[model samples]
Target: MKQGIQAFISYTYTKNDVWLITMKDMMQWVKNPIENSHLTKGYWICQFNDKIKCSEQTSNSTTKKVTFAAIINVDQIWIWQTAFLVVLYIVIYRYDKYMQEKKKK
Candidate 1:
């Protein structure tokens, strides 16, 4: 038997955990990022502060901080092709700064 490329992938994320499950096998958790998957479509989890960890960010009743976030939603998602991302972020950064300066006038 042989395996084939996955057509669709769905993901769910919490503070400490990221789950990438395929349509084929709903039970299995695919950890590796695959090319041409839905992840490329949009929204990803970007976990900053390697030390603090998303788990630690989880909030309780009293203090509520961001627990898990989608790249476009809460945080940014990690993608395989990062070179382009760097450029994209830089452009966004510069654009934001530009907008702020324009408003300051």
Candidate 2:
């Protein structure tokens, strides 16, 4: 909605020996005007292999509708993170104000 860049980082460890970390930049590219080019398209960033390589599709891209399950899964993480940071900031601000008041008195 806002005219800016956003970075999204997420990790999913379904197996004991493997970890999948996904990072996406939420910015529309001039290359893909039809669809959101940043969508994952149900693919992992990497796999357990000897030579790990990541690829990007710069052409012939189609609009991928986000699934409800995916929305719920990712939104929960951001919601909790944002709430915690907001609360932390409020607490710190209040403490600083109280300290200043005590010094003034």
Question: What lDDT tens digits, residue by residue, belong to model 2 across residues 1-105?
Answer: 322212232323223232222222222322232253233333323221222233332233442322111112242555534543443344335445555665699
The best candidate by TM-score is: 2
lDDT of each: 0.32, 0.33
RMSD of each: 13.8, 20.6
Among residues 3 or more apart in sequence or in different chains, the pairs in candidate 1 whose N, CA or C atoms overlap within 3 Å are: 44-71, 44-77, 46-76, 71-75, 71-76
User: Could you tell me which 10 consecutive residues in candidate 2 have the lowest summed lDDT?
Assistant: 63-72
Estimate, for each residue in 1-105, the C-alpha lDDT of model 1 and write its tens digit.
Answer: 322222222333434444443433321212222332222222223444311122222233332232222222123223312422453354335445555665699
Q: How far is candidate 1 from the true structure (C-alpha RMSD, Å)?
A: 13.8
> What is candidate 2's CA lDDT for residue 54?
30
